[model samples]
Target: MISGSIVAIVTPMHADGSIDWEALSRLIDWHVEQGSDGIVAVGTTGESATLAMDEHKMFIKACVDQAAGRMTVIAGTGANSTSEAIELTEVAREVNADACLLVTPYYNKPTQEGLYQHFMAIADAVDIPQVLYNVPGRTACDMQNATTVRLAEHPNIVAIKDATGDVARGRELIEAVGDKLAVLSGDDATAMELMLAGGKGDISVTANVAPAAMKAMCDAAIAGDRAAAEAANAPLLMLHERLFVEANPIPVKWALAEMGMMENGIRLPMTPLSEGAQPQVREALRHAGLLK
Candidate 1:
């Protein structure tokens, strides 16, 4: 199982909105050094919606190559179109990524049957392991517990990234699935509690800036040591909440730049962090001791 803190890593870009491949490598190295167990390249936090198709494939390949087997690399291949999702997943498999993370289709919301069929189609077409990403807040399409349970039966469906942030519901899914498939928390804020309740680990945005801390917390939680997990998580609570002060990757990209990890570069439709939000995010970094 690819467990522990898996960073939904940002795609570093230059001021003109071009991907900075060198910076991307640096971020990956930092994650490996910090002990982050895996990465989801070009996920929502990586601005998957903005990248061109070629860019998406190239980005995933770059992440896989840079990691060089140092950590798990999961390509974010989810799309509203089943064919498109399959193509991306193929690219992930071609690049030898450890797995693929497919989000529930957004916009044109699909029925429960549609959702099931869509995912089943991808799992059937692709031979690689797949992780279902359910973040209704972003996708506007919730894959209900029952639906997820149904999907769990597929051999190719290895895990589910439950971003609902509903600890109670997440626990229910974990209990229902048992070892049929692993359940990873997509919400950093409640990740500790969810893992304590038997969740595998977290697919985290907070891990972007605080990799080591996030990994340590995840390890402790998975070991069922509440005291160690809580101690490690206390400092990161601010980051877990504040990084979303604005739409994702905005505040988080800014936080990374603030820490000199990357430049303050984000694509359009998503702007740089607002002046008002900077102080709040900076304070979060300070609380986590990532900044002075």
Candidate 2:
């Protein structure tokens, strides 16, 4: 299972926006040391849009190599195009990634049937494990319960990263197909609730800055310890809401830099956290005890 606090890691870049492999390796080591059970490189949080295909593949391969079996590495190999998605997934399998997180197609909104065929094509195309990423907020295309259940029948499509933040929908999906597939939360704000309601884990952005606390929350909730889970949840309560004050990786990347974990550099169109937005995010970090 791709369960627990899996950081949707940031792509550490130089001040000039170049990939910093040394920093990248250090970040990986830090996550594993902080007790992150998995690393999701080149996902949305990693600024995947700005990275070229080769760069994406290189990043994934490097993370897999660095992890070296210490933790699961789930490559973000999603594309709006079926053929492109298949190619990315194939490259992920070649790198020996444990699984691939395939997000819904963006820009080109597809019907439910199209969604099914798209994932079906990729699942059939690749022999490796596949986890469907249904982040309707990002893709503007939601994969309903039926579409997911249809794909769930495919053995290779093992799980889901549900970023919808709709607890009811998550519960329904779990009730309908929890036995067939693991439903992982992609949204941090509702991770604990989703877990209590039957989510397997979180594909978390907050985990990048506070892995231990986040992991503790997931572990407690999954173990049926509500009070302990809520106690662990206190520090994360702010992070659950503030990391998205602007756009993801903006506040998060800046938070990591504040903690001296990584450079705050971000690619074009997605700049660093706004000067105005810093104080609140910093306070959230302070509340979480990640910063002062």
* Winner by TM-score: 1
Compared to the true structure, candidate 1 yields what TM-score?
0.99
**Could you give candidate 1's per-residue lDDT for residues 48-74 as a string of tens digits?**
999999999999999999999999999
TM-score per candidate: 0.99, 0.99
Model 1 gets an lDDT of 0.96
Error in Å for residue 47 of model 1: 0.1
Write one digit per residue (lDDT tens) for candidate 2, span 36-71. 999888999999999999999999999999999999
The residue pairs in collision within model 2 are none
**Best candidate, lDDT:** 1
